[model samples]
Target: MTDEVAEDDYEEVVENVALCSECDDYMEHEILKERKVGTGRDLLLKCISCSAINNLQIREPKSISIPFILTDGPHSARVELAIDEDEVFNIGDVFEEDEMLWTINQILDKDKRKKKTILAIDASSISALRTDMVRVKITATRGEQSDSSSMLVEYGTKFTADTKIDYQGEVWRIRAIHTGAGRTLKGTVESQDIKRIYLHEPPNPEHFEPKTPRERRQAWKEGRLGYNPNPEIPKEITKKRVTPSNKRKKKRPRK
Candidate 1:
Protein backbone atom coordinates (compact mmCIF):
# COMPACT_ATOMS: atom_id res chain seq x y z
CA MET A 1 0.00 0.00 0.00
CA THR A 2 1.15 3.53 -0.78
CA ASP A 3 1.73 5.99 2.13
CA GLU A 4 -1.14 8.49 2.52
CA VAL A 5 -1.19 11.89 4.36
CA ALA A 6 -4.30 13.01 6.33
CA GLU A 7 -6.04 16.26 5.22
CA ASP A 8 -5.81 17.69 8.80
CA ASP A 9 -2.02 17.19 8.79
CA TYR A 10 -1.65 19.02 5.45
CA GLU A 11 -3.92 21.88 6.65
CA GLU A 12 -1.77 22.46 9.75
CA VAL A 13 1.43 22.65 7.61
CA VAL A 14 -0.22 25.20 5.28
CA GLU A 15 -1.34 27.36 8.25
CA ASN A 16 2.23 27.32 9.71
CA VAL A 17 3.70 28.27 6.37
CA ALA A 18 1.34 31.28 6.03
CA LEU A 19 2.89 32.75 9.24
CA CYS A 20 6.55 32.20 8.24
CA SER A 21 8.36 35.30 9.75
CA GLU A 22 10.77 36.24 12.58
CA CYS A 23 7.79 36.94 14.82
CA ASP A 24 5.80 34.07 13.38
CA ASP A 25 2.54 36.10 13.67
CA TYR A 26 0.23 37.82 11.19
CA MET A 27 -0.26 41.62 11.45
CA GLU A 28 -1.00 44.65 9.22
CA HIS A 29 1.27 47.72 9.01
CA GLU A 30 1.06 51.09 7.29
CA ILE A 31 3.95 53.29 6.14
CA LEU A 32 4.28 56.95 7.14
CA LYS A 33 6.73 59.42 5.51
CA GLU A 34 8.70 62.39 6.83
CA ARG A 35 11.20 64.56 4.92
CA LYS A 36 14.71 64.76 6.34
CA VAL A 37 16.58 68.04 6.47
CA GLY A 38 19.21 68.78 3.69
CA THR A 39 18.60 65.47 1.88
CA GLY A 40 16.08 63.40 -0.07
CA ARG A 41 15.79 60.34 2.18
CA ASP A 42 13.39 57.35 2.13
CA LEU A 43 13.14 54.83 5.00
CA LEU A 44 11.42 51.48 4.36
CA LEU A 45 10.71 48.29 6.36
CA LYS A 46 8.45 45.25 5.95
CA CYS A 47 6.26 43.60 8.51
CA ILE A 48 7.64 40.14 9.25
CA SER A 49 4.58 37.93 9.16
CA CYS A 50 2.07 39.96 7.10
CA SER A 51 4.69 41.32 4.66
CA ALA A 52 3.12 44.81 5.03
CA ILE A 53 5.04 48.13 4.95
CA ASN A 54 6.06 49.03 8.56
CA ASN A 55 8.14 52.16 7.89
CA LEU A 56 6.27 54.49 10.28
CA GLN A 57 8.12 56.42 13.03
CA ILE A 58 6.67 58.34 15.95
CA ARG A 59 8.76 61.41 16.88
CA GLU A 60 8.19 64.03 19.55
CA PRO A 61 7.77 67.61 18.32
CA LYS A 62 9.50 70.67 19.72
CA SER A 63 8.12 72.44 22.79
CA ILE A 64 6.01 75.58 22.39
CA SER A 65 7.26 79.04 23.37
CA ILE A 66 5.49 81.06 26.05
CA PRO A 67 5.95 84.69 27.16
CA PHE A 68 6.92 85.34 30.79
CA ILE A 69 6.82 88.54 32.81
CA LEU A 70 8.15 89.32 36.29
CA THR A 71 5.75 91.00 38.73
CA ASP A 72 5.93 91.97 42.40
CA GLY A 73 2.47 90.64 43.34
CA PRO A 74 -1.07 90.05 42.08
CA HIS A 75 -3.07 92.85 40.42
CA SER A 76 -6.30 92.86 42.45
CA ALA A 77 -7.88 92.52 45.92
CA ARG A 78 -11.16 90.74 46.97
CA VAL A 79 -13.22 90.16 50.11
CA GLU A 80 -16.39 88.24 51.10
CA LEU A 81 -19.00 89.70 53.50
CA ALA A 82 -22.10 88.12 55.02
CA ILE A 83 -25.55 89.60 54.41
CA ASP A 84 -28.39 89.59 57.00
CA GLU A 85 -26.99 86.34 58.44
CA ASP A 86 -27.63 84.66 55.06
CA GLU A 87 -26.15 84.43 51.58
CA VAL A 88 -22.54 85.09 50.45
CA PHE A 89 -21.17 87.30 47.71
CA ASN A 90 -18.21 86.39 45.51
CA ILE A 91 -17.29 87.87 42.15
CA GLY A 92 -19.49 88.91 39.22
CA ASP A 93 -22.71 90.22 40.73
CA VAL A 94 -24.87 92.35 38.41
CA PHE A 95 -25.81 95.76 39.81
CA GLU A 96 -27.41 98.91 38.47
CA GLU A 97 -24.95 100.90 36.37
CA ASP A 98 -25.57 104.12 38.28
CA GLU A 99 -25.43 102.44 41.67
CA MET A 100 -22.16 100.75 40.82
CA LEU A 101 -20.64 104.10 39.74
CA TRP A 102 -21.80 105.75 42.92
CA THR A 103 -20.21 103.06 45.10
CA ILE A 104 -16.92 103.39 43.24
CA ASN A 105 -16.95 107.14 43.74
CA GLN A 106 -17.57 106.69 47.46
CA ILE A 107 -14.58 104.39 47.79
CA LEU A 108 -12.32 106.73 45.89
CA ASP A 109 -13.48 109.73 47.89
CA LYS A 110 -12.83 107.93 51.19
CA ASP A 111 -9.36 106.88 50.03
CA LYS A 112 -8.51 110.36 48.80
CA ARG A 113 -9.01 112.01 52.21
CA LYS A 114 -6.54 109.53 53.69
CA LYS A 115 -3.89 110.57 51.10
CA LYS A 116 -4.44 107.25 49.29
CA THR A 117 -5.30 107.19 45.61
CA ILE A 118 -7.35 104.75 43.56
CA LEU A 119 -7.09 105.26 39.83
CA ALA A 120 -10.14 103.39 38.57
CA ILE A 121 -12.43 100.86 40.19
CA ASP A 122 -15.63 98.99 39.29
CA ALA A 123 -18.42 97.89 41.65
CA SER A 124 -21.16 95.34 41.01
CA SER A 125 -24.89 96.02 41.44
CA ILE A 126 -26.57 95.40 44.77
CA SER A 127 -27.93 91.91 45.36
CA ALA A 128 -31.63 91.29 45.85
CA LEU A 129 -31.12 90.24 49.44
CA ARG A 130 -28.53 92.99 49.86
CA THR A 131 -25.64 90.51 49.90
CA ASP A 132 -22.57 90.43 47.63
CA MET A 133 -18.92 91.46 47.46
CA VAL A 134 -17.08 94.31 45.72
CA ARG A 135 -13.92 94.51 43.65
CA VAL A 136 -11.67 97.59 43.67
CA LYS A 137 -9.09 98.65 41.14
CA ILE A 138 -6.47 100.73 42.92
CA THR A 139 -3.59 102.80 41.54
CA ALA A 140 -1.39 105.54 42.90
CA THR A 141 -1.45 109.01 41.37
CA ARG A 142 1.69 110.68 39.93
CA GLY A 143 1.76 114.25 41.28
CA GLU A 144 -0.19 115.80 44.16
CA GLN A 145 -3.19 116.26 41.90
CA SER A 146 -2.27 113.86 39.09
CA ASP A 147 -3.90 110.42 38.84
CA SER A 148 -1.07 108.75 36.95
CA SER A 149 0.96 106.73 39.47
CA SER A 150 -0.85 103.64 40.68
CA MET A 151 -0.29 100.07 41.83
CA LEU A 152 -2.63 97.08 42.52
CA VAL A 153 -3.67 96.59 46.14
CA GLU A 154 -3.29 93.06 47.48
CA TYR A 155 -5.84 91.81 50.03
CA GLY A 156 -3.95 91.18 53.25
CA THR A 157 -6.93 89.56 54.98
CA LYS A 158 -10.72 89.42 54.72
CA PHE A 159 -12.34 92.68 55.89
CA THR A 160 -15.60 92.20 57.75
CA ALA A 161 -18.46 94.67 58.05
CA ASP A 162 -17.80 97.47 60.57
CA THR A 163 -21.27 98.95 60.06
CA LYS A 164 -24.06 98.75 57.50
CA ILE A 165 -24.49 101.37 54.80
CA ASP A 166 -27.66 103.46 54.50
CA TYR A 167 -28.49 104.08 50.87
CA GLN A 168 -31.13 106.83 50.54
CA GLY A 169 -32.11 106.22 54.18
CA GLU A 170 -32.35 102.45 53.61
CA VAL A 171 -30.01 100.11 55.46
CA TRP A 172 -27.91 97.73 53.34
CA ARG A 173 -25.47 95.12 54.63
CA ILE A 174 -21.98 95.04 53.12
CA ARG A 175 -20.74 91.53 52.33
CA ALA A 176 -17.21 91.52 50.93
CA ILE A 177 -14.66 93.17 48.66
CA HIS A 178 -12.84 91.83 45.61
CA THR A 179 -9.77 93.61 44.15
CA GLY A 180 -8.73 90.92 41.77
CA ALA A 181 -10.00 92.24 38.42
CA GLY A 182 -8.33 95.66 38.34
CA ARG A 183 -10.17 97.42 41.17
CA THR A 184 -13.67 96.03 41.85
CA LEU A 185 -15.55 96.19 45.18
CA LYS A 186 -18.70 94.10 45.87
CA GLY A 187 -21.25 94.38 48.65
CA THR A 188 -24.31 92.24 49.47
CA VAL A 189 -27.63 93.71 50.56
CA GLU A 190 -30.02 92.49 53.26
CA SER A 191 -33.04 93.91 51.41
CA GLN A 192 -34.04 94.08 47.80
CA ASP A 193 -34.42 97.34 45.89
CA ILE A 194 -37.18 99.48 47.41
CA LYS A 195 -39.32 99.58 44.29
CA ARG A 196 -39.01 95.85 43.76
CA ILE A 197 -39.84 94.95 47.35
CA TYR A 198 -43.24 93.27 47.72
CA LEU A 199 -45.09 92.71 50.97
CA HIS A 200 -47.70 89.96 51.28
CA GLU A 201 -49.70 88.99 54.38
CA PRO A 202 -49.83 85.35 55.45
CA PRO A 203 -52.75 83.33 54.09
CA ASN A 204 -55.78 82.96 56.34
CA PRO A 205 -55.57 79.85 58.54
CA GLU A 206 -59.31 79.05 57.97
CA HIS A 207 -58.58 78.15 54.33
CA PHE A 208 -56.25 75.38 55.35
CA GLU A 209 -58.97 72.85 56.24
CA PRO A 210 -59.04 69.71 54.11
CA LYS A 211 -62.41 68.53 52.64
CA THR A 212 -63.28 64.91 51.84
CA PRO A 213 -64.12 63.96 48.25
CA ARG A 214 -67.51 62.65 49.32
CA GLU A 215 -68.43 65.94 50.99
CA ARG A 216 -67.39 67.91 47.92
CA ARG A 217 -69.44 65.66 45.62
CA GLN A 218 -72.54 66.02 47.85
CA ALA A 219 -72.28 69.77 47.79
CA TRP A 220 -71.97 69.78 44.00
CA LYS A 221 -74.98 67.44 43.42
CA GLU A 222 -77.32 69.34 45.77
CA GLY A 223 -76.83 72.53 43.68
CA ARG A 224 -76.15 74.34 46.94
CA LEU A 225 -72.60 75.11 45.80
CA GLY A 226 -71.83 75.51 42.07
CA TYR A 227 -69.90 77.86 39.80
CA ASN A 228 -72.81 78.43 37.38
CA PRO A 229 -75.90 80.53 38.26
CA ASN A 230 -78.99 78.58 39.50
CA PRO A 231 -82.18 78.62 37.35
CA GLU A 232 -84.99 81.00 38.49
CA ILE A 233 -88.15 79.51 40.13
CA PRO A 234 -91.64 81.24 40.56
CA LYS A 235 -92.42 82.31 44.12
CA GLU A 236 -96.08 81.02 43.99
CA ILE A 237 -97.46 77.74 42.51
CA THR A 238 -100.76 78.01 40.35
CA LYS A 239 -103.52 75.24 40.49
CA LYS A 240 -104.78 73.59 37.18
CA ARG A 241 -108.61 73.18 36.32
CA VAL A 242 -110.01 70.00 34.51
CA THR A 243 -113.51 69.49 32.66
CA PRO A 244 -115.27 66.10 32.00
CA SER A 245 -116.61 65.19 28.43
CA ASN A 246 -120.42 64.10 27.97
CA LYS A 247 -120.70 62.98 24.27
CA ARG A 248 -122.51 59.59 24.33
CA LYS A 249 -125.78 59.12 22.09
CA LYS A 250 -126.24 55.34 21.61
CA LYS A 251 -124.00 52.40 21.90
CA ARG A 252 -124.66 49.26 19.78
CA PRO A 253 -124.95 45.97 21.71
CA ARG A 254 -122.18 43.64 20.95
CA LYS A 255 -122.92 39.94 20.68
Candidate 2:
Protein backbone atom coordinates (compact mmCIF):
# COMPACT_ATOMS: atom_id res chain seq x y z
CA MET A 1 0.00 0.00 0.00
CA THR A 2 1.13 3.54 -0.84
CA ASP A 3 0.23 6.87 0.88
CA GLU A 4 -1.46 9.48 -1.25
CA VAL A 5 -0.52 13.19 -1.22
CA ALA A 6 -3.06 15.99 -0.75
CA GLU A 7 -3.65 18.16 -3.81
CA ASP A 8 -3.93 21.42 -1.85
CA ASP A 9 -1.05 21.68 0.62
CA TYR A 10 0.37 25.18 0.21
CA GLU A 11 -0.62 28.45 1.89
CA GLU A 12 -2.51 31.06 -0.16
CA VAL A 13 -1.01 34.53 -0.39
CA VAL A 14 -2.53 37.80 -1.67
CA GLU A 15 0.25 40.35 -1.16
CA ASN A 16 2.34 41.64 -4.07
CA VAL A 17 5.71 40.22 -3.09
CA ALA A 18 7.82 37.30 -4.24
CA LEU A 19 11.22 35.69 -3.55
CA CYS A 20 14.23 36.86 -5.57
CA SER A 21 15.78 33.80 -7.29
CA GLU A 22 19.19 35.44 -7.65
CA CYS A 23 19.39 36.66 -4.02
CA ASP A 24 17.54 33.64 -2.60
CA ASP A 25 15.51 36.01 -0.40
CA TYR A 26 11.98 37.41 -0.38
CA MET A 27 12.07 41.07 -1.47
CA GLU A 28 9.96 43.83 -2.98
CA HIS A 29 10.36 43.95 -6.74
CA GLU A 30 9.45 46.23 -9.62
CA ILE A 31 7.46 44.60 -12.38
CA LEU A 32 9.54 44.29 -15.56
CA LYS A 33 7.03 42.36 -17.68
CA GLU A 34 3.64 40.76 -17.21
CA ARG A 35 1.30 38.63 -19.33
CA LYS A 36 -1.77 36.59 -18.69
CA VAL A 37 -1.11 32.86 -18.50
CA GLY A 38 -3.76 30.11 -18.56
CA THR A 39 -5.07 30.58 -15.01
CA GLY A 40 -2.66 33.14 -13.57
CA ARG A 41 -0.05 35.78 -14.52
CA ASP A 42 3.48 35.23 -15.90
CA LEU A 43 5.68 38.10 -14.73
CA LEU A 44 9.32 39.20 -14.70
CA LEU A 45 10.52 41.39 -11.86
CA LYS A 46 13.70 42.96 -10.54
CA CYS A 47 14.37 43.20 -6.85
CA ILE A 48 14.47 46.80 -5.65
CA SER A 49 17.10 46.33 -2.95
CA CYS A 50 19.40 43.69 -4.50
CA SER A 51 18.79 44.53 -8.17
CA ALA A 52 18.37 40.80 -8.84
CA ILE A 53 16.04 39.43 -11.51
CA ASN A 54 13.16 37.12 -10.60
CA ASN A 55 10.25 35.36 -12.25
CA LEU A 56 6.93 35.06 -10.44
CA GLN A 57 3.52 33.58 -11.19
CA ILE A 58 0.55 34.89 -9.27
CA ARG A 59 -3.21 34.36 -9.16
CA GLU A 60 -6.01 36.81 -8.59
CA PRO A 61 -6.74 37.88 -5.03
CA LYS A 62 -9.16 35.53 -3.30
CA SER A 63 -12.62 36.86 -2.60
CA ILE A 64 -13.67 37.15 1.02
CA SER A 65 -17.37 37.30 1.87
CA ILE A 66 -18.11 39.22 5.06
CA PRO A 67 -21.35 39.73 6.95
CA PHE A 68 -22.56 43.33 6.85
CA ILE A 69 -25.01 44.57 9.45
CA LEU A 70 -26.67 47.80 8.29
CA THR A 71 -28.76 49.98 10.54
CA ASP A 72 -31.09 52.97 10.21
CA GLY A 73 -32.34 54.23 13.54
CA PRO A 74 -34.18 51.19 14.97
CA HIS A 75 -34.13 49.05 11.83
CA SER A 76 -31.31 46.76 10.80
CA ALA A 77 -30.65 44.13 8.11
CA ARG A 78 -27.95 41.64 7.31
CA VAL A 79 -26.16 41.48 3.98
CA GLU A 80 -23.06 39.96 2.46
CA LEU A 81 -20.17 41.92 0.97
CA ALA A 82 -17.57 40.35 -1.24
CA ILE A 83 -14.24 42.15 -1.14
CA ASP A 84 -10.81 41.25 -2.37
CA GLU A 85 -8.79 39.54 0.32
CA ASP A 86 -5.89 41.98 -0.14
CA GLU A 87 -8.02 45.11 0.28
CA VAL A 88 -7.67 47.20 3.41
CA PHE A 89 -10.67 48.67 5.19
CA ASN A 90 -11.02 51.23 7.97
CA ILE A 91 -13.69 52.67 10.21
CA GLY A 92 -15.71 55.59 8.81
CA ASP A 93 -15.17 54.26 5.29
CA VAL A 94 -18.14 54.63 2.98
CA PHE A 95 -19.33 52.12 0.41
CA GLU A 96 -22.36 52.01 -1.85
CA GLU A 97 -24.74 49.05 -1.71
CA ASP A 98 -28.42 48.44 -2.45
CA GLU A 99 -28.55 51.82 -4.24
CA MET A 100 -27.62 53.66 -1.01
CA LEU A 101 -24.42 54.67 0.68
CA TRP A 102 -23.32 53.22 4.02
CA THR A 103 -20.54 54.12 6.44
CA ILE A 104 -18.58 51.58 8.46
CA ASN A 105 -19.00 52.03 12.21
CA GLN A 106 -17.06 49.01 13.41
CA ILE A 107 -15.42 45.80 12.26
CA LEU A 108 -15.06 42.39 13.88
CA ASP A 109 -11.91 40.43 13.21
CA LYS A 110 -11.45 36.67 12.89
CA ASP A 111 -11.21 36.37 16.67
CA LYS A 112 -14.54 38.24 16.99
CA ARG A 113 -12.66 41.24 18.42
CA LYS A 114 -13.63 44.76 17.47
CA LYS A 115 -11.23 46.80 15.40
CA LYS A 116 -11.02 50.19 13.74
CA THR A 117 -8.72 49.10 10.91
CA ILE A 118 -8.28 45.68 9.36
CA LEU A 119 -7.70 43.77 6.17
CA ALA A 120 -10.61 42.37 4.23
CA ILE A 121 -9.52 38.79 4.86
CA ASP A 122 -9.19 39.36 8.60
CA ALA A 123 -12.62 40.93 9.07
CA SER A 124 -15.37 38.54 10.09
CA SER A 125 -18.22 41.01 10.16
CA ILE A 126 -18.97 44.71 9.88
CA SER A 127 -21.47 47.18 11.34
CA ALA A 128 -22.55 50.10 9.22
CA LEU A 129 -25.19 52.85 9.19
CA ARG A 130 -26.87 54.79 6.46
CA THR A 131 -24.90 57.91 5.60
CA ASP A 132 -26.29 59.21 2.33
CA MET A 133 -29.40 60.64 3.95
CA VAL A 134 -30.94 60.84 7.40
CA ARG A 135 -34.41 61.98 8.39
CA VAL A 136 -34.47 64.69 11.06
CA LYS A 137 -37.56 65.62 13.05
CA ILE A 138 -37.91 69.36 13.56
CA THR A 139 -40.31 71.68 15.32
CA ALA A 140 -40.45 75.29 14.19
CA THR A 141 -42.11 77.46 16.75
CA ARG A 142 -42.98 81.11 17.24
CA GLY A 143 -44.35 81.07 20.78
CA GLU A 144 -48.08 80.25 20.33
CA GLN A 145 -47.73 79.02 16.73
CA SER A 146 -45.58 75.97 15.90
CA ASP A 147 -45.01 73.57 13.00
CA SER A 148 -43.75 70.03 13.41
CA SER A 149 -42.12 68.37 10.41
CA SER A 150 -39.34 66.08 9.28
CA MET A 151 -36.55 66.89 6.88
CA LEU A 152 -34.02 64.79 5.01
CA VAL A 153 -30.50 65.85 5.89
CA GLU A 154 -27.00 64.62 5.25
CA TYR A 155 -25.39 62.28 7.74
CA GLY A 156 -22.97 64.65 9.44
CA THR A 157 -25.14 67.79 9.48
CA LYS A 158 -24.51 69.69 12.70
CA PHE A 159 -27.22 71.51 14.66
CA THR A 160 -26.32 73.90 17.43
CA ALA A 161 -28.82 75.46 19.79
CA ASP A 162 -29.28 79.26 19.89
CA THR A 163 -28.22 79.62 16.23
CA LYS A 164 -30.34 80.92 13.39
CA ILE A 165 -31.03 78.79 10.31
CA ASP A 166 -33.21 79.07 7.24
CA TYR A 167 -35.72 76.28 6.66
CA GLN A 168 -38.92 75.92 4.67
CA GLY A 169 -38.77 79.49 3.40
CA GLU A 170 -38.58 80.85 6.96
CA VAL A 171 -35.78 81.75 9.35
CA TRP A 172 -35.76 80.10 12.76
CA ARG A 173 -33.35 79.72 15.65
CA ILE A 174 -32.49 76.31 17.08
CA ARG A 175 -33.57 75.96 20.71
CA ALA A 176 -32.66 72.45 21.67
CA ILE A 177 -31.67 68.99 20.38
CA HIS A 178 -32.83 65.60 21.68
CA THR A 179 -29.95 63.16 21.64
CA GLY A 180 -29.64 59.61 22.94
CA ALA A 181 -28.32 60.90 26.24
CA GLY A 182 -31.14 63.47 26.51
CA ARG A 183 -32.21 66.86 25.25
CA THR A 184 -29.65 69.64 25.37
CA LEU A 185 -29.73 73.32 24.47
CA LYS A 186 -26.07 74.34 24.30
CA GLY A 187 -24.46 71.30 22.68
CA THR A 188 -24.21 70.29 19.05
CA VAL A 189 -25.79 67.14 17.66
CA GLU A 190 -25.46 65.21 14.40
CA SER A 191 -28.43 64.59 12.20
CA GLN A 192 -28.18 60.80 12.49
CA ASP A 193 -28.38 60.74 16.28
CA ILE A 194 -30.76 63.65 16.76
CA LYS A 195 -34.17 62.37 17.79
CA ARG A 196 -35.80 65.80 17.47
CA ILE A 197 -35.01 69.47 17.15
CA TYR A 198 -36.76 72.47 18.72
CA LEU A 199 -36.66 75.88 17.18
CA HIS A 200 -38.08 79.36 17.66
CA GLU A 201 -38.05 82.52 15.61
CA PRO A 202 -34.86 84.29 14.77
CA PRO A 203 -33.83 87.31 16.82
CA ASN A 204 -34.70 89.71 14.03
CA PRO A 205 -37.39 89.30 11.41
CA GLU A 206 -37.60 91.11 8.10
CA HIS A 207 -41.03 92.54 8.86
CA PHE A 208 -39.83 93.79 12.26
CA GLU A 209 -37.25 96.21 10.89
CA PRO A 210 -37.17 99.14 13.27
CA LYS A 211 -37.47 102.67 11.80
CA THR A 212 -36.41 104.51 14.97
CA PRO A 213 -33.75 103.97 17.67
CA ARG A 214 -36.44 103.43 20.30
CA GLU A 215 -38.10 100.68 18.25
CA ARG A 216 -34.72 99.00 17.71
CA ARG A 217 -34.03 99.08 21.45
CA GLN A 218 -37.45 97.61 22.15
CA ALA A 219 -36.92 94.83 19.63
CA TRP A 220 -33.58 93.97 21.24
CA LYS A 221 -35.20 93.89 24.64
CA GLU A 222 -37.98 91.60 23.41
CA GLY A 223 -35.49 89.24 21.78
CA ARG A 224 -33.51 88.92 25.03
CA LEU A 225 -36.42 88.76 27.48
CA GLY A 226 -37.34 85.07 27.29
CA TYR A 227 -34.64 83.79 24.87
CA ASN A 228 -32.03 82.91 27.44
CA PRO A 229 -30.02 80.04 25.87
CA ASN A 230 -27.35 79.65 28.54
CA PRO A 231 -29.12 76.76 30.22
CA GLU A 232 -28.24 73.40 28.61
CA ILE A 233 -30.68 71.19 30.48
CA PRO A 234 -34.01 70.27 28.91
CA LYS A 235 -37.23 68.95 30.42
CA GLU A 236 -37.24 65.18 30.11
CA ILE A 237 -40.32 63.28 28.99
CA THR A 238 -40.95 60.70 31.72
CA LYS A 239 -43.53 58.75 29.77
CA LYS A 240 -43.33 54.99 30.32
CA ARG A 241 -43.20 52.49 27.49
CA VAL A 242 -46.20 50.14 27.23
CA THR A 243 -45.59 46.74 25.67
CA PRO A 244 -48.34 45.55 23.38
CA SER A 245 -50.34 42.54 24.64
CA ASN A 246 -50.07 40.76 21.26
CA LYS A 247 -46.34 40.08 21.60
CA ARG A 248 -46.75 36.61 23.13
CA LYS A 249 -49.13 33.89 21.94
CA LYS A 250 -51.66 32.48 24.38
CA LYS A 251 -51.09 28.96 25.63
CA ARG A 252 -52.40 26.30 23.24
CA PRO A 253 -55.51 24.38 24.38
CA ARG A 254 -54.78 20.85 25.48
CA LYS A 255 -56.60 18.05 23.80
Return the top candidate by TM-score.
2
lDDT of 1 by residue, 1-255 (tens): 133545435552222122224555654333344555443444444654456554433333332221111112223223332223222223233333223211221222222332122222221222221123222222222224322222222223233233343333444333232333321234322211111111122235555433778756555544545653553232232122333357575988998
Q: What value does the lDDT take at residue 241 in candidate 1?
A: 35
How many angstroms is residue 105 displaced in model 1 relative to the true structure, after the best TM-score fit? 28
Which segments of candidate 1 are over 4 A away from where they belong? 1-50, 68-172, 175-255
lDDT of 2 at 28: 76
User: Candidate 2 lDDT, tens digit per residue, 73-179?
Assistant: 55799998888999988999999999999999999999999999999988899999889989788888886998888888887898898788888888888889988
TM-score of predicted structure 1? 0.17
RMSD of 1: 27.1
The Cα local distance difference test for each model comes to 0.31, 0.82
Weakest 10 consecutive residues of candidate 1 by summed lDDT:
191-200
Task: For candidate 1, give the lDDT of residue 28.
Answer: 39
Residue-pair clashes per candidate: 36, 0
